[model samples]
Target: MNKLLEGKRLLITGAARGLGLDFARRACAAGARVVMADILDELVTEEARALAEQGHDATAVRLDLADPDAIDAVAKFAGETLGAVDGLVNCGAIATGIGGPDMCELELDTWDRVATVNVRGTWLMSRAMVPYLAASGRGRIVNIASDTALWGAPRLMAYVASKGAVISMSRSMARELGPKNICVNTLCPGLTLCEATEYVPQDRHDLYVNGRAIAREQVPEDVTGSVLYLLSDLAGFVTGQTLPVNGGFVFN
Candidate 1:
């Protein structure tokens, strides 16, 4: 209800559906201009159009996180179209059709794919957009990570490794960019019920949710508040940290 992000330009990845889409909607509701980019161009465009019809400042673009050129082009377009971006939410990721390889049975191509999109994609996107964010004078980067990485889940070895890399990279970026007034942090969510989690085996899902302290399943919206906080001015001093939205699934 509060326009906490008024006039801020935010570029969110994987915003066609799920948590990314939820973040875009909430950010716009809070008075921020939003650019929703996803690999699913049609869905993202439709979403953006719907939001625009509701009088929100929103736009959509096709972005493949696994591709370097696509990341570059989208960053450029976002800068030119939305002006200087104040926030970047790295929510774009491949999980269902991409991860779950056992470490011993993992293929090189699979490892590469996960690393490229999850790790490299986050890097490329941040690198490409740093200039615009710097221009804003109060840039914020919220990277979507996973609790699996912190607790060391099995069978999803590659994904865990990639997310571990994400957490590490966020800390390093935060330190390096601190002088520029940019805050970089990781938003680690527990096993959430989304299209991406459908690929996770039922047993694995149970392991994540059944024993959780909250006694409830995690949803996209459950993590939105933490994201909004990290991207808001309130979190100006909260950099190089991992904020877990895991319902006590994994304590710090």
Candidate 2:
């Protein structure tokens, strides 16, 4: 709405639904040409088509972060399509159905799976985009993390560890990418109400709601503003930092 990202080229992952898709739409509305990548190819294509019908510059690409080849392909496709990726939102990860076991009960395969998708995927994607971002001369990277790591949420060992890795990686990335004028930051949201979170137990949801100072459920929209700001020039000087967008449920 503010045209904050006018003429910027953006690549957003996990954009078939939830927070990633919202960020893509918001970025488009803010005057950025976006390439939305997701593992759900057909669904993402449809979403991009809908955005196109509304006169927004949007393209959808298939991205399966589990496969290194897929990640490379998507990044190449986005760079070619966007013509110079000014920003990237690494919002894709294994979030659903990966928790519920305590760390002691968590299987090594499960832990490896979460790390491969969430941690490795974020790192590879960011590496693939460095060239284009450096070319933009003011690139931004917003890695979507979770507040569960900060609060030490129980029975979610793998998810929490993966997000913790993301938070740590962002800071390192900011320092490394800073020389290229690329800002890298992390956004840690609390248990947000999204399709991916529908499997969360009612008791857990209640705990988050009651614990937040805001005393309300967090929706996908609640986080889009902070995400967009990080991708915009307004946050050019803001990097190597983590902001908890969880309504005071856990202050960072």
Candidate 3:
């Protein structure tokens, strides 16, 4: 609808479905050339094809956040194909299955898995894309965090810790990348009902809806507006900030 991102090229990771997919769609609609990268190669390809059919500039690439090689390859593909990567959306994450265990009962492997994908992955992707983004002169990076980190939700220890690290990392990154004119920020969304969140228990979902200021189930679209603003020129002066899109679930 609006040409907020016209002529910009944005690369989104973990874009096979859920919030990442919606971000790709919205960015494309906002006149951006989008590169949808995901570990779910087939699904991401189909999504990209669908967007192309809609007459949007969209393409798909395979990326696994845990693999440094894959991250580098995708960054190379984006540079060669998109030319200038004006923005990056790190939306890929791993959460425990429904009814995650308490930290005392959580497996070390599970903790490592979540940290590797959620924390390390975000770092690697950002590091790999710095050159391309910095070259754009007005680069933007939006890391998808969770409100659980702020609210200190119980049981989901690994995920909460991982996102907490992301928020801290975003601030440090903003300070480091500011000289390059690349704005880095983190967005914390409440428990959203999306394909990626199907593992969340219904009771947890109900709790979120009932406790929210809006008293509604948070959805992917609810967070996209903040994302658009962060990536748009309007937020040029905004960086190293964490904005919660959880409908008042946890007020700052």
Q: Going through the candidates in order, what is the number of backbone clashes in each?
A: 0, 0, 0
lDDT per residue for candidate 2 within 1-252, as digits (tens), equals 479889999999999998888899999999999999999999999999999999999999999998999988988998889877899999999863534777778889988998999999999999999998998899999999999989888888888989999999999999999999999999999888887888889899899999999999999989999998998878889999999999999987
User: Which ranges of candidate 1 are over 4 A from the true structure?
Assistant: 96-101
Sort every candidate by TM-score, greatest first. 3, 2, 1
* Candidate 1 vs candidate 2, TM-score winner: 2
TM-score of each: 0.96, 0.98, 0.98
Candidate 3 residue-wise lDDT, 145-167, digit = tens: 99999989899899999999999
Query: Ten-residue segment with the worst summed lDDT in candidate 1?
Result: 94-103
- For model 1, residues 1-252, the per-residue Cα lDDT tens digits are 479888889999999998999999999999999999999999999999999999999999999998899999999999999888899999998763324556788888878998999999999999999999999999999999988899988777778889999999999999998888999999999988877676667777677677689878899889998888889988999999998788888998
* Better model by TM-score: candidate 1 vs candidate 3: 3
Candidate 3 RMSD to the correct structure: 0.9
RMSD of 1: 1.5
Model 3: worst 10 consecutive residues (lDDT sum)? 94-103
